[model samples]
Target chain A: MDSFVLPSFISPNSEDIKRRIYARIRSDLHRIEAEIDRNINSSIPLISVVARHIMGSGGKRLRPLLMILSSRLCGYTGDRDVSLSVVFEFIHAASLLHDDVVDHAEFRRNQPAANTIWGNPGVVLVGDFLYSKSFLMTVGYNNIRILEVLSSATTKMAEGEVLQMVHSDNLEVDEEEYLEVITRKTAVLISAACQVGAIFGGASPEEEEALRAYGHHLGIAFQLVDDTLDYTGDVKELGKPVGNDIREGKATLPLIYTIKKAKPSVKKRLGEIFCAEEILPENFLEVREMVMRSGGIEYTLHSAIEHVQKAKESLDIFPAHPTKETLVEIADYVLCRRV
Target chain B: MDSFVLPSFISPNSEDIKRRIYARIRSDLHRIEAEIDRNINSSIPLISVVARHIMGSGGKRLRPLLMILSSRLCGYTGDRDVSLSVVFEFIHAASLLHDDVVDHAEFRRNQPAANTIWGNPGVVLVGDFLYSKSFLMTVGYNNIRILEVLSSATTKMAEGEVLQMVHSDNLEVDEEEYLEVITRKTAVLISAACQVGAIFGGASPEEEEALRAYGHHLGIAFQLVDDTLDYTGDVKELGKPVGNDIREGKATLPLIYTIKKAKPSVKKRLGEIFCAEEILPENFLEVREMVMRSGGIEYTLHSAIEHVQKAKESLDIFPAHPTKETLVEIADYVLCRRV
Candidate 1:
């Protein structure tokens, strides 16, 4: 029995939420792990090595879990779900590999980024390999709808990443623009995972829309909490350094909210720190303090909680089932997870 | 009335081959260009900018032309061929964009590589966008076999790139290994283009296989000639530096063959030059001279010509139509093209 660690704000009863969800989905998670390992096998040793480094690292498998649970909720009893669920994970990992190169990131998931180890060229190619592999697997399914969802989602994800790059280090980025970027970059793929799962499960149109909505809100909430944790979470728990967004000049929700609410002097200081060639450690701390003082963290959390509620509400159409229950719990876990 | 320049060895009758092929496919090429522009239209301005920077450059459009021509040869008169043909170009351009970053290439088609203009991050993301867009467009076709061929080809292309990266700067790469690399990195996509075109044209299985064979050999021949041109062609005509392969330490067939046949003294010098941190201009020239003297250029060109014969022979089953004749001529021009 693994110990369940709860965030301070969560009720004590919610501590077992992780345990319950994991217990219910343990078999599915194992299948997903096996499928990922099997699918990522390649003739090129570097591709397999880099792919394993990122995919086998301590990823929560949140996207694949959403996919599997959504499929099950829609009454998909076929064995294909297990294999297909890995597609989302592969796409997610591919984007991360590319993101590592794009951001020149040093660490990811508590270890050196694959680009640092394998070099950017190999990493980029491996990411392409994983992407092509995902599509190849989807092609085997012979379901055009699933391909449509996955491909469009990936297109949006790329556009989102480019949008984020365009907005990087620009203090003028507003809340709407930030939301658009996050929606395309982070939420679209998660939503696609659920929607594709629903499609594979032969879901009704309404049910598919519900699951899609559930994933959309949950993805936003997940990213909002992630942004908040970047400032507030422990480096050890987060498995990456705190204040990375500020360091990288990414204008996430917390920073956008803080900038919106900051006083004139604080806003000026924030502008200076963000615009400077290098952000000093003291400046990072000052920005974090300002964000917290201005209720940016609380505001982001509040927004996340709202989205989580909407996500759960989106699942109301599905009747009582262990899969749906676990999915609901997963939504709450999105907010409570430290990493 | 563009004048055609023939390589010194080509008969004067073949000088008109390029003009004849272009005159035959001019409308199809125009349609392909327009379709590409339409398909590549993106909401993200940076994507459009970077994509145009590469796609609008003086690319020969060889892959798309093969697809269009192959489809025509198969007797498909539908409008979809024009749109579908652009898919090949989009995928090719996407790979090149990523390759620019991967190779740190300074020039492509006589202009600065897109990475140098927009930076690597944007280039990588735009490449991702183009890839996704290509997949999304293919999904609209509702053809599983086409998807299978393309997805598998892209998978191999990525593997090929990683294999090439693994072999980069390694002097021990032999002829067979070089062939494997080029087949995956270059031939696979081109083969896929022709195969997909045949599929779209509703070719019989034998005819489909023949076109696939045609494309496979033509792609190999195309790459072989490219490798030879790297050693022998004028830099301005090539639109990139001469000896780039050697400078990048890429062991193409010419280099590999030279290494195999060189005397011990020349072999020792070749090793020293290839192993050096940076290849000097004089070292590049010396290596080129050695390749020529050892008949490396001749051997590679001879091999390319053999493949071109095979490519042309693959179309023997088809009745002599303008499209088939042009494809044959295109095979001849592949050997004769200096760029």
Candidate 2:
């Protein structure tokens, strides 16, 4: 969620959070690799090649880092969170790898997508491998709550994918429908990351609910910003192909928002171009221009800010803690950052 | 793995094992549907439609029943063996549903395939849904060892699929390589079912190993019979087109064996037909006849008997109990029984 990246005032605090998480995640990443080799009977090198390449591709580590920081905010002292957080990261990574294959995406984070290098079969199976391994790690906790939360998130993620498949290119998609898909596809896991932290920390039910709501709102803010950025993003800065989501025919938030406010005649043209068999690069620019002029981008951004506000306000229920402040700060960063 | 089917056997003891295992499995089948529904969280109607169709298809429940019986032989008393065994079946069923989509298969177990009824996307997503659900159920156990065993089996199964994909139409596939694919594709989970049972019963490592061997051999034998039945099996018994695998150019054991033993010219003809886009239906029958005449089917049956014998031997290490007897009987059943 680019919205979580704040400027000068929050930079140091965010850096502090990242610094603490970075250290644990590094070893946790290694441990995950070690376990991959130790437990999986496949040839070690293939797994290592795909794994290291992706792990080394250098993600923002946003999800795993959030999971760890969430656990810290909840005062988690257990060692399981590190492994569990890594599981969160691996599941995230695995899904991306498979998504690239399914979407035939050529790049991720400006690096060659793993599927591009490994081929679709390896990518698909390896993604399945990581999923199985993630479950293997989580089973150590034996908490039905833990399993239930993560499992439900995964199911929702798949449903979201299916929903996207059904809705993609159907240019009449409204913001509500787009929000539902992205919430399940992108936000649920982020939400689960925080909720699981509260779970593993043995937080009170009220606190857990607050944490879940916080993560859910924060993730919504992050994804809304992502949808906005896709319209007016710098591919170099975002590390993804500009207009990639639209090319895939997904009617993401900004476009949907714009369509909502547009005159019916203008909306019809936008819808037609989006549903067309072929779209020129110029169409991407033209569509973005239309949305900006119509104030749709601004509206989506405002919606993101609202979510971030909700995310931060939910944090007030928790007693003061350093990590809590960082949590609140991250929420603020998501909406203001310009990735 | 049809190399492990029954000879013309006169022993009543083996027959008794069949009856007992069937009886146990029949009752457990009811719970399998319930467990599947409890875990599936899709649009309730979608889940209901798929689950109802699948369980209502009248599957033999052989694998789950075998798992339960094998666990019992190792002195397991807990009822969890049944749930775990159902987990085994769900994975099996889910794989078939997905495989039908990947292979574009039209039929399964003598009925119209789920994909044909539900369409590929619906079938594929539901398969994924079922798979993740199975993982969730396995995670519910909280036993690291069991989780590792089943998760590893799942990975093996995926790799096995890739192997099968690559080896398609490869008539030169030697017996050993053929065995490797099926072991992962078909046997590992069956083996894990028994092994995990022993583990859950707190059996010694040696005992678990022995139980795993039994299941491994039995599974190989089971699959071997399936391969044979593909050509020679009764449609009423096996369901689906018996000749489909051959028509699709699968270089299974019967074909591999006959090709190895055939006259050089016959082998050349076999090679020509395998690579062609379509083989004459008569040519398919000719190959079948040749396989039978070359003793391919007979040889496969003997191998099945040998595996079942070995499977029985794996249980001799245990003290005499009715459960042990039943397990031994199951091994015999694998070699001998029919629909």
Candidate 3:
């Protein structure tokens, strides 16, 4: 796995791109998986059980990969990157645990949510444990700069969550507001992961900022793709039901765009659908068709593609290397992947 | 307030002791209060509203006071202590927010819980916000030791919560298990507050350890008194209903002690009461009377007194400064406070 070779050219197909990327990063991913497992061990059995139920359920390890790849690109050769990479995954998993409970989600990654399995109290506490553990692990690095980046990221993430909650079910959500929510909720942490990795790798200030920007753009693209999948992807492929965002009354970019371009009659119908006691399949299909007709899906994907371009362009400061190529490929994969 | 003098001797009455301590720490408490308010300000109006709803309600601010007093005892004469002390208060408030949601609590501090008024989602998000904000503030200090102490305390606190949840409603929970739970849940954070203060104050290793031990014993005594109050306190005085611990299926020290000593018939009745779907007031009264008859209340209070004694003894290394005297008074007040 350590001697794995990357394809010379980019693959257009999502599956092939993902397989190639996974093969190239397989060793790093395995170490990240093991580190995540080791870090979550607790004296209390329930914490470990709940943490594993969510974390072990086939996450893509995207954030950790970004951290590792960023470090490698910045010329890091130390063993600590693997352990430090786990910090991002822990923070990500912790947020997901809390999100599932807050959303009253029934399923996550094709399994019953941890909160549903263990009840909310245990799940909530385990989420807290993971969060604290992440910070504690960072402290072991003894880097104040890294701590600042990670802590600030968490603060923004929490505020982003509250912003999303406040806007849930409200039809007046605009593109700027939606971007603000996603930027704080998803992009900041990813950016932090890259920035911390850059610091660990002894990157110059310019190189660190470049990686931060790259992560930010990639994170936004990733979320935009995710939101688009809610309208376009198959449930089996995505590991979650389509139209879930709409079902939860979350006004993602696609919906926001569709509402802007929608005629008053169609807008009234969408308002009715969203305001209903429950959104039915027919209503979802009707909204989906309207969104397609309004070019909302294409607009969202186009925006994501633009962000991916920016993410790749941000790597211009670094000399061409296998790690940099892999990062660019990963950015492309984020845009193309079905899940 | 700076010129206020401590009482020459200890007061047996709780109110007198509390009055003297408050008078001595009144300025520090005011600064902490203002800092807490300033730190909670958020761009999202709802976040600020929900944070203020719970935080503006009456709180003893014991954790922050301990930190401030410990710093003072260690000869800290810096302005940052006021802001740093807010970190402990924020963490304490964050835990309370999540706890109320987990416990499905209707009232906190004689008012509707933040969860009840704002719904669990907003409350939970705000809790996360506070938790993240607390860590973010600690990062500004650029003190890795302080950050390490806080992160570890939070991790233990979360584990303690899960441990308590696992044991909830179980009839077989023993003294050792209960002590473990309280130590992590309550004592760890208090001890961290003191230790962080000591670190900031440039205390010697012996002085720092002394304060840490002082806080641990004081925290245990504080929780013991709180548990006893649940069985014997007035609703008006405690700011919540009595017997809440048992109602929530918590086996606190009083109930655990009572179970160990109760006769077979009484034990069976207690089990039946605990198992009931709804414990009527009559059931609570019967259990309270039984706990009293079995000397559970006295036993718990006696144990608290012992801890209080140890807590005072932990401070013997420090010279008898006014701040030291205030800390002693606060420890005594913990044993005597009704709420």
* DockQ for every prediction shown: 0.90, 0.30, 0.80
Writing each residue's lDDT as its tens digit, candidate 1 over B188-276 gives: 99999999999999999999999999999999999998998888877777788888888887999988999999889999999999989
The model with the greatest DockQ is 1
- 1 or 2, greater by DockQ: 1
* Candidate 2 residue lDDT tens string, A83-131: 6777777778777865775577888877888878867656665666677
The residue-by-residue lDDT of candidate 3 on B1-339, one tens digit each, is 011111233244878887888899889889989988898799889989988888888888888888988998999987889888988988998899999989999999889988999998888889999999999999999999999999999989999998998998898999999999999999999999999999999999999999999999999999998998888887887789988998999999999999999889999999999989999998998998898888888888889889999999999999889999998988889877877
Instruction: Report the CAPRI category for model 1.
Output: high
Q: Model-by-model lDDT, in order?
A: 0.88, 0.74, 0.89
Ranking by DockQ: 1, 3, 2
With a 3 Å backbone cut-off (N, CA, C), the pairs that clash in candidate 1 are none
Off by over 4 Å in 1: A1-14, B1-9, B12-14
Whichever of 1 and 2 has more lDDT, that candidate is 1
Give stretches of model 3 more than 4 Å off: A1-12, B1-12
Better of 2 and 3 by DockQ: 3
